[model samples]
Target: MAASEKQVVVVGVDESDYGVHALEWTIDHLFAPSMPDYPFKLIVVHARPSAASTAGLVGPGAAEVFPIVDADLKRSAARLVQKAKDLCASKSVHDVTIEVVEGDARNVLCDAVQKHNASILVVGSHGYGAIKRAVLGSVSDYCAHHAHCTVMIVKKPKAKH
Candidate 1:
């Protein structure tokens, strides 16, 4: 691809409502009527957490159980990416590409941006408390600063009290 031929808009997705919101926001705001002038590919990315995390949680004898857990995780990730693809198709955004990668969410997403030659990366914020965010490290926060492309962090709607 040429230096001026940047294509593909990469969106980080998952099974959460926040992920859905990010996809919807992309369709509603960026690709709604479709821009012929700025035609681009839509690459929906979902980062599956490493199986080691679960293996560690299940204790020492986890080797026997890790395969089952890993399989389930793969199935769940496939379902999530498929749902995101279907949602985009329903919004008239067909020809979407789905990528299910494994690793830390931040690294996976940033890597996707570079791999896809995307100019923009969209992700949703989970709105965790400050302490939780500090401890866990927000994916959106990491992507905003680390991604090679421009980043859009969508916020999920607040529930009515």
Candidate 2:
């Protein structure tokens, strides 16, 4: 199939192990070279929190602090994207595209699906409890409901004790 004719699969990733595991699982399952023809294009997306949002502060030397915080956020985003790229490379999935969008993960991922006309959106579950999920707002849950395409929430298997 031509490049543009391939279906797009967008995976949201973070620094968490769950996110890494999801990407790995997606690669192993969906992008396996053994498949006759690769019909899916992989897009790895990282949602970066803006420095102002992360800082959650204003006034009183906030101006001086903003630039420093922004720089740190940029570095963190670079590291996260690099890690995702390295993982894809290690899996022999080099045709993947990586994006760093500054916003909430849920919105960024949903927008990515629309922007890329994705057929599937995959995200890792943090496995938070109900109360925690309520407080923190689950990105996978939100994407599952709001994204136009199919959504897959990859959960890390519980470790054997």
Candidate 3:
């Protein structure tokens, strides 16, 4: 890999424990000391529900119902991004970028993969049960099938009793 061919890995992130676990796993498994050097860069992507979705949730006139909720959402997204950056920094992974966009999570992640020309798209599993998955769907599941690049779904390590 040359200067123009930096290796980029895009990972979906959120405030969830699984999200943090995915980021940590990527650093440990992909960028560990034993890996070959290629100017690796990690891109953290988070997707917030669209403003329309928020508006709908608040009610018909909710678009103007509460500006505070919109503001709060933005702040929350920023905080999550910052936390992810800090985690990367602590792990000695400095070449990191944060992307917080409002849209469907699956689309946001897929778009990031194409925009970054990422060779791998990493996401964490929430381990939703059959009922929940049928109702709410899974981000990792969508990404695995739709991402332009290779997809890695990181699962939380199970604890031993």
Candidate 4:
């Protein structure tokens, strides 16, 4: 089947283990080789925060710091994409696209869904408390309401003491 004919499944990932676990869950449950002729195309997306947004500072030395911070962010993004690719490869999922988009996670993910014409948008929940989620503005929550497709928020299981 042509690429365009396949239903797109966009998975939003980050450096967090929660995001990684979500990807794993999506693969294991939806993209398993055991499934007969899975017609969905997998696209892994990483939203990379810009240096200025992450630096959280504006001062005399800010200009000088931007380059270094930007480089670090680029490296981090590369690693994140590689990790996602590696995970997919380990699962025998070779026909996958990995993207690193520079923006807030919520916006990037939603845009990716539109750009890819995705049928499903998968995100990992941080499982924050009400106060923390309110303060930080949960990306999963935002995407769940704003994304144009079905959104799946995967929550990682907590470890037992």
Q: TM-score: which candidate is best?
A: 4
Q: Candidate 1 — what's its lDDT?
A: 0.86
36-120: candidate 3 lDDT, tens digit per residue: 4636678899998765576666447675755767887888888898889888878777778888888999999999999999999
**Each candidate: what lDDT?**
0.86, 0.92, 0.86, 0.93
- Tens digits of per-residue lDDT for model 2 on 1-161? 55659899999999899998999999999989698467799999999998899998878998888899999999988998889889888878888899999999989999999999999999999999999999998999999999999999999999999
State the lDDT at 124 in candidate 4. 96
**Which segments of model 2 are wrong by more than 4 Å?**
1-4
Candidate 2: lDDT over CA atoms? Answer: 0.92
Quote each prediction's TM-score: 0.89, 0.95, 0.88, 0.95
For candidate 1, the per-residue lDDT at 77 reads: 93
Backbone collision count in every prediction? 0, 0, 0, 0
Collision count of model 3: 0
**What local lDDT score does residue 17 receive in model 4, on the 0 to 100 scale?**
99
Task: Indicate whether candidate 2 or candidate 3 has the larger lDDT.
Answer: 2
Give the candidates in order of lDDT, highest first.
4, 2, 1, 3
* Candidate 4 overall lDDT versus native: 0.93
Tens digit per residue, CA lDDT, model 4, 1-161: 57558899999999999999999999998988887567888999999999999998788999999889999999999998889989998998888999998999999999999999999999999999999999999999999999999999999999999
Model 2 sits at a Cα RMSD from the real structure of 1.7
